[model samples]
Target chain A: MPLPIEIVLFIFLLTTAVVIARLEDLFAAAMLTGIFSLLSAGLFTIMDAVDVAFTEAAVGAGVATVFILCTLSLTAKREYQQPTRILPFIVVGITGAALIYGTLDMPAYGDPDAVPHGHLSAKFIEIEEKAFLSQDKHAAEPAQHGSGEKAVGLPNIVTSILASYRGYDTFGETAVIFTATIGVMLLLRTRRREKKVSPPNRDQMETTS
Target chain B: MQWLGLWHYWAVIILMMIGLYIVIARDNLVKKVMGLSIFQVSVIMFYVSTGKVEGGTAPIIPEGGHDLVYSNPLPHVLMLTAIVVGISTTALALALIVRIQEAYGTVEDDELNAIDGAAL
Candidate 1:
């Protein structure tokens, strides 16, 4: 029998993980990492959690990979020595085990009777059409009385939430990007004195006799 | 075969862990960064995989109103923004790498550390 899609996705994820683990070269690993991200994004499409997938694809796959590659280029690719740390690994293992134990009480994946489906989600899906219609009716009545165009313009609730309801968060995120940019510029910029001492300066004086 | 259902998620988690391990354990700066990439990609995979529905197709609205099952479009939309962010990050990082290469004679972590130590 053909494997279930989830299983297949799992296999892909596992394979990528193993590959990433064994890879020695930094560049190759970075590229593989990108492939892993893309594959994960594909898996997310299969799952139906579009929003999380989107963030993963953008930040995890795109930006993070690029950042890694950039850092790699700045540093050496090969490890000079093997890690001898055992205590940290043990600590990590213990922590992970504890977390997994905590998750045992959580609902199974896609259980129709799960709390999320039974509560808010089912209600939202059931009433979405009615909500849209009511908004439409309200929009039809109120061009002069209120800003009708602004009220029902965006289709996706998440978008509206991001852009309007939580606009401050968005503004903060933008500020973060701006800060990062400035930080990079400040970190990378050379002083005037450093810039003036070209490689040829010492060589030229020595050659002139 | 029997364990297929939940195994995929576990696999993703494993991959993520391995990637993270490389990032933290490796002494080479480049290797560490590569590990970071691996870690990030695994997370993307984990999120994307969570969005799948059993029998769903792509979320594109079919022409002429034919009733067809489609995947959710929200993930795709979110992914576009992510791609843009990724590109921007990559550009900035690469620029930093170029600068680092110019400043340091070698990119080896140990050598850099030694140079830094000497400077101090």
Candidate 2:
């Protein structure tokens, strides 16, 4: 039997990751990293996380690649040679070992009895289903649950949870984006200042000459 | 059978280790950012893997359907927050890299440290 598409894509993801790690040229690494992100997005889609995949494709493969390309243009493409790698290697090795050991107690993949499935998410699903069922019986009238707006009529439960059930968290995430946008604006603000100051200095030099 | 079930996690661990090694072993600032992105991505993978169901479909409810086995949506929602955070961090890191290059004329950690050491 042939390898599953997921396994094949996973192989590609791992290969790109390794290649990105080994490449010395920052520009090439950036491109490979974009490919890695796309592959991971594919993996997310395969795992039934369509929203996550969309965000990954946009943010990871698109915005991140553009940001890195801009940074690459600003900095040298080549990396400087390092003197020693022993310590960093040992540190990474130990960390990886610890993490692998920690995974020993984790629940197996796709197990219905997994702890995450038993949480409040299950309750959310139950509520959503009940709302759907009630909607069928009350087709002639408006949903009485409008008092609480509990019937998140969206077909995508992920969207409903993200936008309604966990609206505060989404608000915080938006605030985080706003903060980062401000940080970037502040960091790169000098260019505009320089642009404004340059013409006057050049004009003064020309007059003096 | 247990080992087969755990391969997904082990692969993620390997990817995470590679990212860690890049962050630790590389001197280039931009490369470190890339490694950080990879590390975050592996974390997303870990979370998404946990959300997978054996026979699950996407979470979108079809018309008048209630028996569909949808994969866990909570992790997907949480990973959306994480994905946004990752992008923000990457953007900020890149901005910082640009500023560092402007200041030191080099993005290499050792060179920046050496210059700072000389100044001190």
Candidate 3:
């Protein structure tokens, strides 16, 4: 039933990517990248990643588009056309071919017995069920919970694992975002002081390009 | 030849290759970053695809909903946080692009290289 929709969305994804590639107007390209991200978010939704879809729509499509547009305002609007480079094409082709060849031995899509679904995810899902179960049991006792009966007591499995089981990794992710914010802020801030370092001597500078 | 099962991966591969080509072939710094974004998202798609079970729904378990199969939420959590973090880093990248444009006249790779070669 939904497979057709998935195929259609995947096709649109490919089409949008191609259009973005062919587009020369930097502004339109930025807009198309947002569209591409939005399409990918829809694909995520179809694949049952509701939270992933939400974040992709908001961050990937929304904030990212705005950032790209802001940068375009500061820089040139049209991409400078260069002569066709065969080396890059060859490189991409080889890498893509290798990746395709690598996937040949992988399990079929949506196979219930696939490695990821069979291992840690199965345990996590059971934990999620238990968490939900304890929520129901909470109405009866209301005191016996959160010690051992309830593990990662969030109704949403993704949030449960993210906040509890994977807390350290999420902390690292937050740290990365914090560092990026600091980097951006430092880069964009206006300096009030004059140049600190001495200018490079013109005698030593040579035209090498 | 399970074409029905494998075609999705192949299509994703093509999309990924397009992004890779753009990153390598495009001289525009902003465009390269966008290509890099595409590449990263494709990886998420590949991982999420692996987490799907045939009859699985989203991983939000309701009260007494244990009988229902749920898609693996690990990839969803990883990719969700990753999307946000990726955008934060991309914002930093764009900020650097803005600084590069201010210091130099263009964001083209070769032009920037040319400017660097000729000046101290």
Candidate 4:
């Protein structure tokens, strides 16, 4: 019962992806990209990644789409039709085939005993377990609040891991965001005066600025 | 043999290849970026798939009790940061595109190349 919608969402995702790849109109493609992001967000939710889904819906579907439309306004709307090339198709096929062959060793989807679950994930889960599920009757040691070690003190284990365990990565992420801001500002700066030239001749438009 | 179990990974791979194909094959810069977005999201899907447990719920600690299996939180955290980074990349790429459009007056890869070839 739970998986029926899950499968449907994946199907929708695949469909939207193909359509996006084939569509030539940049406007429609940008809109479909938003649809694709929302569909992927739905898939994320079904896979129990609510936080990821929320962020994807907001950033991927919401902000990315708007930014794209903004770019579209400032640039060409219709993509110029070029003769299709086969070499890239062959390259994608070969890479995809190799990747598929590699997946044979990957753990099955939703496998609880997969290697990732055994390491730090289990401990992260246990930390929260000790807090709320003190009466856990599993083979693990009884929830001895034996030491004064406080539970993560937050309900969401994801946040605790991100803020504390992986704080350095978050710092790096912040730095990355800051650097991106600087890059955007530098790239978009129009320093010289602009001529009222036609949009097609925009190459020299920024030169005067 | 166990294709049924690995179907999700297969689809993810296909999606990735589609994204790669768009990046490699398409002449339009914006479409390539769209493909890049799809590719990034598909990778996110793969990692999130690995984070899922058969009977697991979201990685939030529940108030009533703790018998429920919570999916792996590490992947979610990593992917959260990844999504943020992804948007940043997209933003930065779009900025570059805007600059490219201004300087070349076109976003087509071949056209831009032609422009450069003429200059040389």
State the lDDT of candidate 4 residue by residue for A31-86, as single tens digits: 99999999999999988999999999998889999999999998889898777788
Local error of candidate 3 at residue A158 (angstroms): 0.5
TM-score on alpha carbons, each prediction = 0.65, 0.92, 0.90, 0.89
Model 1 stretches astray by more than 4 angstroms: A1-3, A51-71, A77-92, A112-129, A133-139, A142-153, A191-209, B1-9, B40-120
Each model's lDDT comes to: 0.55, 0.86, 0.84, 0.87
Instruction: Give interface RMSD (Å), model 4.
Output: 1.7
**Runs of candidate 3 exceeding 4 Å displacement:** A142-150, A192-209
lDDT tens string, model 3, A64-144?
999999999999999977788789889998999999998888888888888888778898888668666766876565432
Model 3 Cα lDDT, one tens digit per residue, B4-120: 586667878988999998898999999999998998889888888877778999999877765898999988888877786889879999999999998898999999999999996
Please list the residue runs of candidate 4 whose C-alpha ends up more than 4 Å from where it truly belongs after superposition: A132-151, A192-209
lDDT of 4 at A118: 89
Q: Where does candidate 4 clash, by residue pair?
A: A192-A209, A193-A209
The residue ranges of model 2 lying beyond 4 angstroms of the native Cα positions read: A1-3, A144-149, A197-209
Instruction: Write the residue-wise lDDT of candidate 2 on A16-86 in tens digits.
Output: 98888788878899989999999999989988899999999988889899989988998998887666668
Q: What is the RMSD of candidate 3?
A: 4.8
Kindly provide the TM-score obtained by chain B of candidate 2 when compared with the true chain B.
Answer: 0.96
Candidate 2 lDDT score relative to the true structure: 0.86
Cα RMSD, model 4: 5.2
Candidate 2: residue pairs that collide: none
TM-score of chain B taken alone, every candidate: 0.77, 0.96, 0.91, 0.96
Candidate 2 chain B lowest-lDDT run of ten? B1-10
